[model samples]
Target chain A: MTKYLAVVSSKAEITALEEFAEQKLAKDDAIVLLSHPYAYGEQARLPGSVLKTSFDYLNREELVEIEGERFRLVPNWYKFDKEFEKSILYKGIQLGELPFGEVDVFFRENLRFLRGLSNAIRKENPDVVLTGKNSVAGSSVRAVAEKQQVKIIRYFELGKQRTFPLFPNLTTRKVSESKKKLSRILSELGRAKRGSKKTVFIASRGYLGNLEQELREKTGFNVFPLELFLLRQSINPLVAVKPFLNKKKLQGLFADAFNKYKQSTGFRENMVFDGVFIGDLFEFKLQQFALLNFPEFVSLVDRIDALFQKKKPCLLVVWSDFVPFEKICVLTAKKYRVPSIAIQHGIFPAPIYKKAGFIRAFAPLTADKTAVWGRAFKKILVDNGVEPGRIVVTGSPKLDSIYNRHFEPEKFKQQLGIGNKKLVVCATQPASSTNNPYQMVEQVLNVVERFPECFLVVKPHPVERTEKYEQLVQRANCNALVLQKTDLHALLNAASAVIIHSSTVGFEAILLERPVIILVRNQKRSGHTGKPRLF
Target chain B: MSSCLASVLQGKKLNELKKEMRKFSLERNICGDGKATERVIKFIENTAKKTGKIELKTK
Candidate 1:
């Protein structure tokens, strides 16, 4: 009578679980696969056997059903807000009191999934837990399983057959063996086109239209986008021939990287900003994540190094120093004596957390130059021990996109089905600041409710999972526009009033000259309808 | 965020902090036009020339 708690964080794992549900395991071998209830409801194919109940029991008052689905509702602002405060405020005595940014914010989001998983683990009391591939959900499940003293079986797909390991780690043998085989098909090493132009390697998708054009014109450098952006995407078709690279050299580099992991002291030894006790905890977690990811990191660095060796690029420009790929690329570029530059991708790392010591904010270590939004942003780096000379103000290349393009408010209003109504744009972060996602959405809804003539336009953060918000909209049946993959700057420009928690979007609203309101946990606005002030 | 950040997020009583940010932007307005990118290019080219290692095109 084996009880199994299975979790699906991958599409492959989802298909595998669906197949498993069809099979009759030995008697009393009941399985419960816990996932985000709303995640599977409309999008994924999930069976009732997965989880009998849902965490969404929110609205008893004025329930609105959408497409035959009723959303449980609650006022979530305070609860979610408190949860956020707890996760970030643990930084230190002085800096801990202030709000967190970037890496700390990611941990706060992971804490939500961790909470859900911990509850599921305790209630089900399963003998074992199963999940797939590397993701925030997978990491959260692993953390919970370790605390619960439960065994976790991880399955990774390899072409047709799958490798199921009780304690799964992405090891060198599994990685190298695949690349060695890839060398058979891809036999030629990728050659860089050596033009009279100085080459500069870029690691992020060129999202901004004019920035690259301007850089090439001013710098006289051939802007080369990195070949592999992630697991599958190719930034350049030519870089795809990297698989044909000398397998022996890649294997050798990976072996060295693995050895370094075994001998190396964790980030704890290197990082000075994080204060005592929790710093120790962060080091252990981040070190583990880094080690588990070492082989892949080594492979990427080696691949990029191959390009650097051939092309002899003068500069390497990456999105940020935080991401593992970008980190490796920066280090690799340094090894080749190529100056690496990190452009501000999102909000300039907020001043509050950078000075306080957010862990992954390690761009200063490798980047010769760190481009920022303005002098205030430069101060964030300099105050945190980054060299004053290294920080450069680039304003945001992303914002320059807004300056170049324009959207008609009338067209947007018609497209959104809110004809001639004043649009109160309520922007959301990709991750919730609080435990409850709906509470934040509902708070904005409550504001929109005030103006019967004005409908709410919910703009999602770029990195957000909008399913939770989508579910809330369906259940509440609010007259809100959830704009995904739309021109956000135009909407903000056209907005009557803008509402946001502390985020880069809020700053953008201010830059756009829109009336702004900064929502927080405990606050008193004696009168709700006064003119909006700059946040 | 510095101590003044608390004041800014509060949205009011942070006039000094806002002024500081505004002043910072004005002083560092090299981001205007193509000045920031020009600085980056000039810096990279000068370093390359100083090294006398790489032949860079600085048109």
Candidate 2:
């Protein structure tokens, strides 16, 4: 019998793969590797007996050996390359001098996912690996399949037609010289104006509410975009040479870790979820990633140093110190004795057992000062070990526009076409760093359908696509308007009650004095007793 | 999860919800009262003055 392994990460993938298996792989023995099973919610209906590749398998407390050192797997995955970092020195600056520590948090999850998939593939030993076309997961599959020497087929939907395309033959297009020149011209034009006005560098990825404009109008400080400054600076390859040459040290470190990993029975057995061990899977790729990014990091160091020396800014206002660029700016600002403030972007969650490390990323405020929304946030930060004196309860500058402007609730309701009905705004955020909003959106939709009196308005997170939620709304046949780009404050004004899944908008709803139902996934954290309580 | 939502939707526990949210907000001292922008501007002004980055343009 022919053996097949179907790698499905979402509901759409599972559905397409099932249809394909029924038509083509009906006679063949197939097993399904499901990740984010909550996305689609049906695993039993998949083509074969399902083997979950979801993070559900991760034992967060499990210990693993890397280079003869036993370390906790989940929290310290980024530290696997710690030794490599120690050996590198760029332009008389150490690796730790740059804001590179928290960057690994972004990649750690992907490494774990890739490691899990590699283990599953080795265990299954399928003839062909079938998966749906996903930019993030597909790259991982391509890499794993290429290494395993297995044939891989990707299921793609072009309009209505379902096409199964084979991998390993695609080639990339080169950037034209003229296009590069145009980009450089554009970058030069977009560079922030450096003038006599004392500047306050606003470190942001767009979306800073009214703070940017308000700062420009109300304050003497010129509001400069931190990102624009980074982009405007030309990269110097000479600064990167030291780290590039020291790439050998990284390879040696990974070799030591992998060799030690293979021999450790405790790690091989306990650190594994299914056959996947939370060990070094992408040793070569990670080394390359570090080597490539080190140059950029070194360049950023020089550029930030230039910013401090040239601009002589009074203060640096940033979104968060967790972001690499912002972190670098803040650290550099501190060296120059310039004060930096990190404005809280969202409502901080109360302490949770599993989310301790993740929550700590927000607390103890990375900048010289932290401006929070209220006393509640200050309390949370203080509880999380941040010095209270450094935190200023600045309220939310983003919400200032909402308070200042007038929003007609009836007009917003009319726009939504939910006439005279009580509007219940369901605000959603792309929960988790993995961007798993599907399951949360599905859960909200299911609950909203039961209440006929309430007219549901689904406001997706700014980063999320509206079409996906619209598709979900269409499939459910529910009477809910999925507004991707709408004034959330207006919607909150129209809402009789707000339903939220740990989104900052829920806090806004509270500020507007609208009743809020916080839909927390953790039953214990939701403070559930016999009686129903809105937490 | 849906159970609490059901209670809120049914209008059976809205007062309870509002009360809980109010208590939560009060304890945390949430809400900027529309003065957040003014405060942030003031902070910037004070910082600039303290640092003597630029001479104040007195109106």
Candidate 3:
């Protein structure tokens, strides 16, 4: 039996891929290793038997020890130690044993943990190592695979495609140069070996339901849903905690408590306990941390270096939204003689801040092949400096579901207890310094009052002040429902019409075959009332 | 910054803007030309071929 090692960044992605892998390969023979940035203890375990790797109690200590031999500990160990101490000490209890403060100790500890992972892979001596796209653990696996002379495969979940227009002010010259540089780099990486049984992983949910089998039939590359990753984390004991403590002090305290608890419980080194903690924190904050980690940067550089050293060609396919990371990937691809193809995540239009002139003019020229959602966005790319030849129109996969949806309005209305009445879905926009939701509510109420038979569904933007909406709903004294969940397809399907002020939901409503009215009331210009512009 | 200001100042009429936007609407053409997935796959394949690798079987 061919030995294969699958390293995953998150348990969610792991669980998602496990089902697909099980269908393709025997469960017993294939080994799956899950690496989380923080340890989640028993909570990280999968349903089936699988090996796990994570940061241990003395992760910093282990990293420090291994730093000199392998891996440069950027920002130094002292900074990490200070951060660790600060993270733990300020979290809850004012006084606890001060954790080891030496930067070298921390670096050695982390290095040891990484080595342990590499050693495990070496022992298994797997022919192929697979990981999710763009994660710390994924990057580490790539590094280990390179060192061990093992093949590396990455999985990515593609999302909806939309065409965005370019603001006219930005020029095409700058955009073309950037795209050319990226293209040049990707071309240098070379290509996969011909006739080799290439292991392919997809992270798209769209492919999971209806497209999986179709994709499999079409591509012959393994088509796995992103749900596998979700499953791993869902079953993990660490995933249950609600970590969104509003107070920073409380959050720190919880981290300290977690560390102490892990130590007492005899938690192993390099387990992703931090992930569990961070997962419980705000989603935005977690994303911010992931962006700052620089794992993607290191991994791209390392891969390019290896490719160059071996005189082998490689091609990297990446989503464009990871632009900052794309820069690193592009530069590394260039250095290592690799070719990269940037698939569009959504429509790229003229930069919103195009009023900033030259800054906007130079931004879109970064990708080799700029795959857009439609001709409009394509033109925007061309106007922004992308070579028209390099731009491809690949409609968004997310819209596939939208296009095929067939909703019975009466059935949905009955389910939601909405009687025979005209339904108006009032999708809220994000509240800005100049945009007041309260005033908009007043205007909407005024309109609703005129039509008693009409029911209003006031779905406020997730980040907006909920209390304000509640207060407005009360003030309006009209029958209303506020949508909390992100998916509003069902409600949209059942609506008679939709009202919003500069929201993407309006576009979604239009897709649902509903009339959309934009209501703009800028606080800066209170007296002005005009038909709002639809983008 | 001044250049950005100048462009905004040179704004087109609403009707003209709508005319420009007509090309993006569904009436003009289905954005994907009705074979988006296939197009994407082909692009990937061509890219792979250029890099000297056989296209991975999509199915």
Q: Which candidate wins on lDDT?
A: 2
Residues A1-535, candidate 3: write the lDDT tens digits. 5456666545455654566465666655566564543322113234344664533122334433443332222222112233343443321211122111222233333344456556666666776666655544454555455555665465534223122222211236434533554343234223323343332323332221233334445653433222332333223334312222222444344445444434432222222221212121222222322232222223323433443344333454445413333444444454444555565443222233232211121234444565556666666566555678887777654455566667677877776777887677777654221234545665676667656777777888754546656666776667776655434777876776677765656665655555556564432232224432223
lDDT of 2 by residue, A32-137 (tens): 5646323433443653556565343333321111201221343443333444334444444454434333334324455556655676677777777777664344
For each candidate, the alpha-carbon lDDT, in order, equals 0.51, 0.60, 0.45
On the 0 to 100 scale, the lDDT of residue A276 in model 3 is: 19
**How do the residues B1-59 of candidate 1 rate in per-residue lDDT, one tens digit apiece?**
11222233334554544464454335544254434444555555665444434433221
Model 1 pairs in collision:
A58-A72, A58-A73, A59-A72, A59-A73, A80-A434, A80-A435, A351-B1, A352-B1
Best first by TM-score, ranked: 2, 1, 3
- Top candidate on TM-score is 2
Q: Order the candidate numbers by lDDT, best to worst.
A: 2, 1, 3
* Chain A TM-score, cand. 1: 0.56
Candidate 2 DockQ score?
0.32
DockQ of predicted candidate 3: 0.10
Candidate 2 share of real interface contacts: 0.51
Q: What TM-score number comes out for model 1?
A: 0.56
Where in model 1 is the C-alpha error above 4 Å?
A1-195, A206-209, A217-219, A227-292, A349-365, A401-407, A415-417, A431-438, A523-535, B1-59
Local error of candidate 1 at residue B50 (angstroms): 5.0
How well does candidate 3 score on lDDT at residue A492?
76
Q: Decide which is better by DockQ, 1 or 3.
A: 1
Best by DockQ: 2
Interface RMS deviation of candidate 2: 6.8
Q: Fraction of native Cα contacts kept in each candidate?
A: 0.14, 0.51, 0.17
